[model samples]
Target chain A: MTDDATRGPDPAAMLAVAEEQQARALRLLEPDGAVIYGAWGVAWLVGPGLMWLSRAHDVLPIGVAGAVFAALLLGAGAVTAVHVGRRTQGVQGVSQQTGALHGWSWFLGFATLTAIMAATARAGASDDLLALLWTALSCLVVGVLYMAAGALWRDLVQYSIGVWILVIGAAGALAGVPTNQLLMSLAGGGVFLGAAALSRLRRRA
Target chain B: MTSGPTLNGLDPVIHAESRLRITATLAAVDRGDRLSFPRLQKLLDMTAGNLSTHLRRLEDAGYVEVTKTFEGRTPATYLALTDPGRVAFATYTAALRALLRPTDGGSA
Candidate 1:
């Protein structure tokens, strides 16, 4: 013990190192950042249901589902971009790159899914298969994005949420399309919205 | 392996504390990662004048790339590390590690 005290670095220098580490913590965003992602989740959750209802009943608004889909896409993107652009005014590297990746992956995934839906419809596949494919593809996009986000930011909660989506998607597929749609609404959208709320609460705390 | 931890290998250009911190911070991001000037200022918490001075030193070394652009009415300055800068930072880290390692024959 006596020998250690004589050889160790100065206490003041060590304190400075500790303080620097604390300041570095600010490099990470507050939980409110993730709350914006909840909007995307809500879109995923409700979009399928709206589509199903739109087809089932023609009495409702003419293009409600399609309109909602477009709205959610643009709306979520705008809101999240604004939130990130403002929140990340200073910490620009990781957050900025992650945002770009998130946007591109979602955009590409949605485009691919839309193409798949169109092709299947033209190919005369059963609606059940079409629904399953839709759910599966949607789930995959959510899962991959979540996992990528988690890996980039090193966030376990977001990563786990991705896993949850993958599992929910898989289970829904196995059970069939109707079940898958419900799960997308419940487990898929449900958990996202829930996590967003939780993030909000944590930020307040 | 000589007598003790070595400092002879450190790049003199980035040897100082503030500069080392700045380089390390920049290095943590990807090669092309551009950080807004205001953001970098906040991250380093140094006076704008002093920060600019240090940045100028690194710029002269060809280690940092700086860009100035207008975001609406405001001018935004973005900074990223050049390839040479990244290599220099990596070399600096290796040297620092070699310096901090124990001199005794125990494997670490």
Candidate 2:
């Protein structure tokens, strides 16, 4: 093989190419932020919005509202799975493993938390108390998970969303029942939608 | 006086412009992660023939691994940097930095 002395390309030009290619690679690796954030935003808004509407007005039955909320959450989960899977398709290695493990963590975390909450309800927790507990704890889990993801990826937008969710969750708990639902539907959902827009703008920039 | 190996230390295998760009792109991926041939070509904006030629050179030097497989009914080609490739690229960058470093300790 020839040495660098025999090669004619300037070192500075090569360095520039390296930097440019690296940036391109990273961009290709990043999942579509707008889709992810938007899916959650829609779910957060409509799900809790329905719940609050049922509570405030006698429009839909609470049972139906609850069912819709659960369904929306499931839909959001499915979207996240599909989006991530498609993006990483044909790629293998530590990144794929990391994504798989992280996805399982969310599933396991919610399943365990739900089981514990259900147990509390069975043990004579009042319906109102159960509702507040579920809301607070659910938000707490999402907040913590988002923050953990942000830290792992070093994404400021995700970290900020986590902080906002935690704050909203706390405020909603203190506000109580119907008000809490409204707060979550408005404040919680609002932040998610706002973040989605911001993410899109940042991508464009 | 100069202390160690200078610009002469740069790996000729990776020193070429196209090969350097290819190596840099592959290096950005997570260890062991691979990029599809079409994807890498698009990223580099190189013609398939051009990319294949450079890739062969890198593969020859044991710096790259190219895998051919079937994705459903379609043929697919994926490429990744071998461990030795990573080391070579790292060493190349270090030597490049050394060469670029101002001899009087000024900013490069």
Error of 1 at A8 (Å): 19
Docking class of 1: incorrect
- Candidate 2 chain A: worst 10 consecutive residues by lDDT? A1-10
> What TM-score, to 2 decimals, does candidate 2 have?
0.77
On residues A1-205, what C-alpha lDDT tens digit does candidate 2 reach at each position? 2224245578777777788888877676677778787888888898888988998886899999999988988898888788877767667667888888888888888998899898998899998888898888888988999899999899888888888889878998999997788888888888888887887897777
Writing each residue's lDDT as its tens digit, candidate 1 over A1-205 gives: 0112123343244334434533463444332545575887778677756765555554345267758876886787788877767656654555666667777888888888899889989999886788788788778888888888898779987899999989988898898856676677777777878788877776656
- Give the number of colliding residue pairs in candidate 1: 1
- Who wins the lDDT comparison? 2
DockQ for each numbered candidate: 0.16, 0.40
Cα deviation of A113, candidate 2, in Å = 2.7
lDDT of each: 0.69, 0.83
Model 1 stretches astray by more than 4 angstroms: A1-33, A49-63, A87-103, A125-129, A148-154, A197-205, B1-34, B42-47, B53-108
Q: Which regions of candidate 2 are displaced past 4 Å?
A: A1-17, B1-11, B15-17, B36-50, B66-78, B87-108
Best by DockQ: 2
